[model samples]
Target: MMTILDALYLLVGIMFAATAIINLRDSLNSKRWKSAGFWGINAIIFIFGRYLPPLANRILVIVMVLLAGLGGLGRSGKPETSLEQREVRASRFGNRLFIPMLLIPLVTMLGTFAFKSLTWNGALLIPAGSSTLAPLAAGHDAGNGAGGRRKPLVWRRSRLSGLGAGGG
Candidate 1:
């Protein structure tokens, strides 16, 4: 039972892996344009998909597919270039931007894990789980009156205190 966020994260991970594989294939085939285009699509997907909903995600995917298809076909019309020749030409402009593109997912995963660990104690109690410490979990106010409705513990950043506040 993966949440939407979890599924999105997995999708992003797979996209990055696919991009890396495509990059490697392009390197071996002397297709630098394909590699750059794939990398560009990867960046666009990551940024747009992370910030937008499924509708936007689908739109971005469609746009990337069209762009990649057109760009790849367009490049095939040019003169055939050797791998070394392409590398020399591309490197002349210091266009090694794709190298940092690989780190986006790595940094995202690290930051997610770090934030979860720091904020949630590395445990997501799914309400029905049998845990002795479930009562202490955030938003778990079992006997806090108000017709048994659980009240979330709000934290005041200025005072650094937890106040049980009901969302009225």
Candidate 2:
């Protein structure tokens, strides 16, 4: 059976492939052959990196470093968006601009509470209490701390905190 991590790796691989496709489109626009090759290779790594042996993975990493560090994979791309265009976009999408940002926490909140209650064949998809959630919840809690709403709580009983970051 594929574990949750396998699914996540597959999803990430898909995203990497998608990025390569997008970069390929960008390369076509700018006629940057180097950019095309770099992204194309990166896409290969993402899609196959997980399945490769440790030695091959290490070699791939070295190739990536050489391709990017010295090869300038990201250079020579023309600006697709200028400052005035960005300003116009911000004005055009006021308020809606935050929707994408808010969706992250909203998803985390819902996942934390809702997924905990999910079960398959009477066994929890994720156990009732697992540290797997701590990192995710820590980020959310840290965001709250930044707003000063959670600072007092954090200062008071950091020892009693549950999320990985420790707080009230």
Candidate 3:
């Protein structure tokens, strides 16, 4: 009875882990240890939270808050890119940079419909009640790849039909 949410959790865990690693490598940042700890704990929670006791999860969250309140999370004082450099990049990318942002919703809608009745080995691919949420997560995952690959026209038509069914 695995669901796409499980996969999404793994993806989130990986992202947090990467953030933790980057913070840990910030040699110039005096607070790197604390920042890395915060992100590392977050990674553990995302990956293993479902298996952890609720009380344990709460305790971990409290610890994260404490770290943040104690000034644990922060970036290195030295900017990775100067303001001028950032402006140059932004100008180069312009509106095209927003394509990924726009694709999130489109992909979410399509993925919801596509995954609604999907299954693997006789088990539902997405939990019965999470058609929208699971696909939204998948859409965010798609953002990382900068991909806006289109599903078949049949899927789009099917979704449209379903939408119409709900309207009247």
After superposing all C-alphas onto the true structure, candidate 3 shows an RMSD in angstroms of 12.2
Query: How close to the true structure is residue 87 of candidate 3, measured as C-alpha lDDT?
Result: 68
Task: For candidate 1, write residues 1-168 as lDDT tens digits.
Answer: 543344444555455545545444443345555555565556666645556787877876776677567654222122344557556655763534333344444444444444442323444522222222222221122212221233222211111111112111
User: Model 3: residues >4 Å from true position, as ranges?
Assistant: 147-168
Model 1 TM-score, all chains together: 0.27
Order candidates by lDDT, high to low: 3, 2, 1
Tens digit per residue, CA lDDT, model 2, 73-150: 653233344557567766876776555456557656766776666777776666556524633544444444543344
Model 1 per-residue lDDT at 95: 39
Which 10 consecutive positions of candidate 3 have the poorest summed lDDT?
159-168
The residue pairs in collision within model 3 are none
Return the lDDT, model 2, position 16.
Answer: 51
Each model's total of backbone clashes? 0, 0, 0
What are the models' TM-scores? 0.27, 0.53, 0.74
